[model samples]
Target: MTLHATAVPFKDGASTLFPGGLPARGGVGLKPEHFREIIESKPDIGFFEVHAENYMVDGGPFHHYLGRIRADYPLSIHGVGLSIGGESALDRQHLDRLAALIARYRPQSFSEHLAWSSHGDLFLNDLLPAPYNARTLDLVCGHIDQTQEHLRCRMLLENPATYVEFAASTMAETDFMAEVLRRTGCGLLLDVNNVYVSCINRGRDPNAWLDACFASIPLSSIAEIHLAGFAQDYDSSGASLLIDSHGSPVARAVWELYRRAIGRTGPLATLLERDNDIPPFQALLAEVSMAEKIMYADAPRALSGEVCA
Candidate 1:
């Protein structure tokens, strides 16, 4: 499945070679509950994203609905099981399936997390963080390189929403991500909620983290932005802890951060991610609308008449 690197143009910053790429507007995760409604109602969404693992099967109802819905809207495929930072080499069979799925859909975007979810033969269900160091950096870059070569498309790497940091880490998270992007020539799926949750849980200012990212990561490398809601909790030490639980609506604080992010990225494609406590399609669309409004407000000149009402 190894393909030439130049088979798919590498996307960097605002310049893109992929035609009909994901629009710089708001979208939501396409859920089964909302599939029929989406197909029938035809909401004014900019695009739809689906977890790649869900649609890996050869043929089924998931494919049936997705095939139908995808006809009218742009699609982004998000992967949760690539384990790009895992100690073990990637699963070849899984990667092959992923390549097949992407070929079938020809999605405008494809992305995976910087975190790993597997070790050896056992696959974990959670997205775990990796140490920010030279060794881990090289491992991630190699994995991403393999992925791009196999799929023949550039993929976006998402920042993790972590509850803890590795004590042996030698580099900051932003620097690690920047270096990975530089080495692999992949785009970034800047999950703002992950930034807010990880920073709040680690006793750091989220704004400061965003500032570091803006200063380090190239704005063009950021191909997409994700906005989600988090669950709040308290640590054993009585400090506030935030969980990257994609339930509920986008929090006020996260929205504010997203507004700031749009200011820097200049109206990049945004997704409102909700995995648990699924709500009606209208509710998710409302959140999408709110994101569109924020994007337009932050970059009116760039987004004028581009954002759907």
Candidate 2:
């Protein structure tokens, strides 16, 4: 299942594929708590992203508000259950449902993680890591090809935040992701918090990791950015560990890294994700405002309609 044959070239950048896509600004994850407020107030934001799994059912309050909200803002559907990096063949039934959801909403962008979450029939509710080797690379690329072929739309592959490393892996995570994008022609959803979390856990400098990523991954392939909060913990070795908790406000260090990322990638459709310890809608909007300020402060050209090519 080599998908390179049907891979669409991201010649300029991922944004070029959809002219009327998400604006180059900040967005917040659409939670049920904020749905009513969003519809009533119509907050001035760049876009709204929702997890596809949450809206997989028919005729409910979720769809009721989402239908109304989608009309007013750009929507990005992020899938958490695709298991694109899994060893088994993709679940076609699940894919069909996802496709239906996309068709219903007609979101501006669709994305999934570069990690697997299921094995056999037992579905793990976590995004587990995969070994970065030749076999895993081929499997991931094939899955992305299948997803794109079925959805008839290019999807963004988000980098994962891992607390452990596979000793069997033969390539760096950044290199592996770069190869995946090259082989599949998919866009990237660069999660700055993930970078910081993974690096801090693995005893690497997040800034240097970002530098390495920029050198390998093209700026154009990066269609969106994700900022989230992480919980702090200590491993058995008494070393600091960062968890991708998404339970608090974006940290100061993560914000600094995001600034550096935007300076390089220019203004992208950035997302502020807070899945746990859910805060008030106004609090999330404040974080969104912070992200907007970083984008404009670091890349003023974004206001002039200049983005990465």
Candidate 3:
């Protein structure tokens, strides 16, 4: 059994990935540009996700708008920093700021990327990859432990869509993430788009990779799911590299993979992750509607135990 800090504890459920019933639909990275539109239109999206760092301000119009919206929407705090993959220790100052926001807003859920961003108090602002090994695994678990201890809540870690592999690596992505969950009581924020990007870039079968990831992680630990766009990269040697750019519309292959993930995870909290090249609010809402359609499209078949290949 898992341990909790207080007498009243995290609600026990079927799997660690999903502690309870998830809202099953949402939009990603709700920005200031759409704040007024969201309230005016009140798009039918189930939940709203925010970058935890964005709300770390003292007092401003941003917070003012966010407060108005917060009253209406179920919120999820997704952190881009925290640098769990860094060689050095996690940044306490950043974590303190995050904790303060959580206290103020009381988000329904919280998450951060598994990759690192800063080094030695300097912020790189890009999620960098980590080599999977026992040392790195231990380091990551320690960071997760510290984060949960300080924040006083369960957090989600996202897998990185990596470009390179280390020769000395001793574990696969699935095993590494599962180990972290087991050791630190943290949860997984499975990004289906990342899986698709990594599989295409690394020349692996996406389905096989998904199976490997699912085999390692217990579904109970999955707190949420992510879907985003990837940029096609070519180097000086003219080789193809897929980057998690989140700059375009959802790729066709990614949508198929998301269907597969939704099948396995079974209606977990889901988001459409767009950062750069974000179109009008309607375009994203269309994506949101598409995701909802896919998630509930074949409800009867899913109930009857019919699996799609």
lDDT per residue, candidate 2, 1-309, as tens digits? 122333554332432223366788899999999888898899998899999999987788999999999889899999999999999899999999988887788788889999999889989989999999999999999999899878777889999999999889999988898889888889889999999999999999999999988888888778899999999999999998999999999999999999999998877899999999899999998999999888888886655665444
* Model 2 RMSD vs true structure: 3.6
**Per-residue lDDT over 1-309 for candidate 3, one digit per residue giving the tens place of the 0 to 100 score:** 233232212433322222333476756568888888987987778788889888888999889888888788778889998898898888888889988887787777778887889898789998888888998998888888788778777788898888878887888788788778877777788898888887777678889988887887777677688888899987567877899998888999998988887777766678888889878988888888888887777344554554553
Candidate 2 at 256: error in angstroms?
Answer: 0.6
Candidate closest to the true structure, highest lDDT: 2
In the range 106-202, model 1's lDDT, one tens digit per residue, is: 7899899999999998989899998999999999999999998787778889999999988999998888988888778888899999999999887
Clashes (backbone N, CA, C under 3 Å), per candidate, total 1, 0, 7
lDDT of 1 at 16: 26
Pull out the clashing pairs in model 1: 13-220
Candidate 2: worst 10 consecutive residues by lDDT?
A: 10-19
Q: Lowest summed lDDT over 10 consecutive residues: which window, candidate 1?
A: 1-10
Positional deviation of residue 181's Cα in model 1 after best superposition, in angstroms: 0.6
Deviation from native of the Cα of residue 123 in model 3, angstroms = 1.0
The all-Cα superposition gives candidate 3 an RMSD in Å to the true structure of 4.6
**Model 3 misplaced stretches (Cα beyond 4 Å):** 1-22, 299-309
